[model samples]
Target chain A: MRTSITRNRILTVLALAGFVVFLVYAQTNWDAYRLRILNLCAVYTIFAVTFNLIYGYTGQFSLGHAGFAAIGAYAAALLTMSPEQKAANFFLAPIIPLLRDVEWPFLPALLVGGTLAALASLLIGWPALRLRGDYLAIATLGFSEIIRVLFVNWQRITNGSLGLKGIPDHTNVYWSWGAALVTIFVVKRLVDSSYGRALRAVRDDEVAAQALGVRLFTHKMMAFMLSSFFVGVAGGLMANLISTIDPKVFMFFLTYQIVGITVMGGMSSLTGSLVAAVLYTVFLEVLRPIESPFDLGPLHIPGIPGMRMVLFSTLLLLVILFYRQGLFGQREFSWDGLLNTLARLHRRVTGLWGRTPPPSTVEKGEQ
Target chain B: MSRKKVLLVWLTLSLLLSLVAAGPVAGQEDEIVIGVYEPMTGPQAAGGELTMQGVYLAHEVRPEVLGRPIRLVLVDNRSDKAESATAVQRLIEQEGAVAIIGSYGSSNSMAGGEVAERAGVPVMGCSPTNPLVTEGKDYYFRACFIDPFQGRVMAKYAVEELGVEKVAIIQDVAQDYSVGLAAFFREAFIELTGDAKGIVAFTAYQTGDQDFTAQLASVMAKNPDAIYAPGYFGDGALLARQAREMGYQGYILGADAWEAPELIEIGGSAAEGILITSHYHPEAELSPASQPFVELFMEKYGERPSAFAALGYDAYMLVVDAIERAGTDDPKAIRDAMAETKDYEAVTGTITLDKNGDAVKDAVILKVEDGEFKYVGTVKP
Candidate 1:
């Protein structure tokens, strides 16, 4: 009981610290463009986390996340906009009477969009859940392409690849990070529950889990639907942030990027994914100024415009090659460990000055 | 322990102090920096590279603007709207660019325009023909006519000149330029023909798609007088080749983006007789301003300049002219000067900036013949 209480205290401290840091960063950089990118990062964090729930926790390999995202983006875009704008741009207004005339607010549109995406996942998951591993990956990849093709062709509904633009920019850091926080909290709680254990059991050995009274299909479908709902919400957020939604925006390449984030961050670790997302965006931003040619004295190297992609791909390849288990693997960063290190450093310095303290007492105090 | 702690605190304080000491310099002198943000990679790389070549060639000819050495900082936006905004911001905040010239695609230009407008930097577009790029934005400007005018001119060419009644449009739906042009063309064609249903069928394809068999099959079912496809040259060439292979003997109409050397290389014999609307033609024999540019371009590049190259050249000259007229590197002054541009004799033609910041110029119609794009005639817009 003492250990459990100490763990809860450490968790609470870490949560508060993280919130304070985030608030400081957001307030310091009040630029709309920077805030927009932060909001996008938050949306992506939600996507990567939910994607991790399926591909990492449940061991389901699917690449249709972006396709579902596109569905949600267009749905939310269509749902929230004034009917006159929809009629002018898309030509085919939503046929459902309730959806047709109603210009739903941003939050309701996002919720409804996520619900629609969840329904789509149910429709696709019913057939796709029967498949395993590589087959599932290929099926989902194909489904993403089909959705993109439909968005390109169904101009009447999706404006046929011209993309839905002029979307309201209601996606702020508060909304995005708030959703991200809730997603992390809920996903963490769900993963620690009995349902998570059953899902893990199925992932480890499906036949055995079935024999052990685990409802395999039900658990898998629930995980799939929940993951799709969060991903759909991320999509709605993304659409609002970019103020546009093109079919190309949800191409297979986007799925590849998300998969890359998951692999580089460690599949089963939420903290790892979060850290990786920040690192990836920061690295790309820092590398931009270096793309131009440097003017050192007596040497003028011309700029190579295509080198950015080369560097990114090469770095990604190196990470995959050396660290196949990912940078953090499955280990989550703990505040207790960080505090212990700080205490140890203090003790070392004090001991060097000829005054040694008891480590056990300090450890107990930290606990 | 106390000494070490004091030392650590002092070290951290010094580092912070040094960082603060390295803050803002007084003023930037010695170079006139201009930002060139375009899609140097991705599906639109070819167009972007050609446009860059045009801008680079302009600097090569005259490296000074207002008696100061011109420095062109090229930023690759990777053809993404979000990245375009970041690129523009970097140029404005980091590079201290006096003006920005970019963004071949309409969406990219529009995205960059927002950043430039917010930062109070003048953004001169190279080939983004969207009117909305400069509708109300005072800082945004372009060197080409808008899609509505270009689309209307092409529609007139298709209906009156080509004597086509029913036209089918196979557009790249992912491209804002293509979609906007297609919509305007449809509207103009219907109005010209006085029939609301003049178009037989309108199909769509995404960018980077190589196969057009499915779309072509559907389009062929409805036999129209002509097929209008306003897409990039790569996709347009493939579509032309496939359509011809499928025995489509209708007239094919394209936009300025289809006037590349690769179009002929890819489409081969199938590209013959394909007509496109453009702003520049090396063979037009315009004026004294164009003769030297065309001659120099052919001498340097071993081929005549495409519409994009000419437009890039015009964009740089226009910006330089604005700086010279304004007599300062201030973006607001340059923008004011740019707004007052009239009868600017460019290689493309005589350009006049209208109230909406679009160039009111003549449109050149070119037709491919014998593996080369031949100048047909100029239609005054």
Candidate 2:
């Protein structure tokens, strides 16, 4: 066990080192299109990681990501926008006096956006923490819709449905990936703590956890607040990265995508969420040609739009059917487990072990 | 089954799938690639598909430019803002397109315009009438009249022809184009009457909202001379039907977005007397380019082209015309020549690009009658 822990730490250090090198290469060499996809991967990584914290660790099924993200995106976009740009965008309806001349740097704007989202989550989670399972999801979904509608109609503040153009392009690979890493690290540390055990206990059996004095509401609210803050920050990054936003951008569809990511990645594994988000972002980009006009032999298959989404949804369905426990299940990535399995396979092939079966590294205790 | 086996199988399948995917990245060398980024699928799919048909028809009419076959590399924006920007990026960076033409929606055009502007590639827009699409941008150019002109044309018709003094405005707040046109129309109508209270009621609804009884009830209670509801054809038809059912007798005026045939079919008898400003009328051959475009479009598609199709055809022709005048396939040269466009005749009308890359063109008013669109007189800009 001691050796395994050391090996895991070493592997993590090496992996991070390799990632830093890759980031440098990407920033220097990749074009705007490639870098955009890369940035999207990081943004989604933040969303998925935060979602995994709420839905996976705390077992709270909330569909209010869209609302939180909209708040963050609008907040950041408004704050970071130059006063001149704001005046130009709100030509139809003048901006409110409070926000007309306000301009903050990207970092402060993102932080404010996150803080606002956290406050909103506190208000929402207080009442919503009472409901469990599907009811919570429905309530959160309704709240998200309300947020989108408000953004649509509140022309004075959000520019209504006309959308804000020329949002400062401050999100690059560094900002997105840095935020994603922070979210993962924070969630990982929280989940590994004693507080995390209480949250899991509440998830596993809420009545018994309450009997054991777990303070279910507090734990759930903690997870909810933390998750929303990162999600909001991720939303701000997306607004900057896209350089355009409107209420339509935060429709319930955005929440659905994050849910799909969290579910497709293991319901428990942060590493799975990280990997799945990147895969989702990249595969969406890489699969573009499949929808483009292509000639197969003598038959010309004119490009069918929306086919990529159809194929993607079908692929997602297949994965769920085949791997009912999700790709990672309750397991987390570990270097020792992988290396030991590879070594065992090698020995089996060489017949050096003389038919002695290697021990399985799959964690026996399922949360 | 052991979990390890499932993981291994999934990993192996993904690797194989990626290997298979690598086969489809072919390069074009001889073809002059003009990238098209439009919403091929989503809420705006109908408009995008119709406009692309015109682009296809025009490509068939004139397949080559600068002695090279024009290959239109189209990327679907999926009616998403982020996707629209990336679609433009992919077209300019990966596809090596000389010029871009796209984006039926104003929001889409604005989003894509930023990327194209940054990349220093010129984009020719089709039917995105919002001023923001081409405003303060050198790269984004459109072949369609802006919203203010469309609004002004309807306002002029209401005052000079119909003599309606009181007009109520109900706009789709969800759409930038609808809101913009409605605002412009209100401004023009108020200005023409020189009365701040010329507009009786100003109401709004969202896109994709199926119900409008409340809006109509409020609009009808005002007893205005006419109601100007600038929105997409779906909403326009719905509003017209609801307004007539509510016993509102005043004329219904809408913007060019109501030019689709669905308006008549959906609105039925209520659609009669609804005056809509259009970019082109198939029967009204205003320019020499109009008749041939109409004939070729009907021959190819077996139907008269919609206003969107006309704008699409014009956008394509204008791009190719700029390429010819520039005497090179270079994007910079094409942009320079396109910026210098004056009195360029296309299917839509005689277009001269303004300083902001907006086309100056005349508006055509079409009235719905006997379940058919009849051409009224043209309103010169």
What are the lDDT figures for the candidates, one per model?
0.80, 0.87
How would you encode candidate 2's per-residue C-alpha lDDT over B265-342 as one tens digit per residue? 999999999999989998887688999888888889899888888888899999999999998888889999999999
Model 1 stretches with alpha carbons more than 4 Å out: A1-4, A7-11, A14-18, A21-25, A28-33, A79-105, A296-298, A340-367, B1-32, B66-69, B130-138, B195-198, B204-224, B299-302, B327-330
Listed in order, the DockQ scores are 0.23, 0.48
**Candidate number of the best TM-score:** 2
Model 1 chain B: weakest 10-residue lDDT segment is B17-26
TM for every model, in the order presented, reads: 0.87, 0.95
Estimate candidate 2's alpha-carbon lDDT, on a 0 to 1 scale: 0.87
Chain A TM-score of model 2 versus the true structure? 0.94
Give the fraction of native contacts in model 1.
0.24
Q: Identify the leading candidate in terms of DockQ.
A: 2
**CAPRI rating of model 1:** incorrect
lDDT of 2 by residue, A71-179 (tens): 9999999999999888888878899999999999999999999999999899989899899999999999998888888888888999887889888899999999989
**Fraction of true contacts kept, per model?**
0.24, 0.41
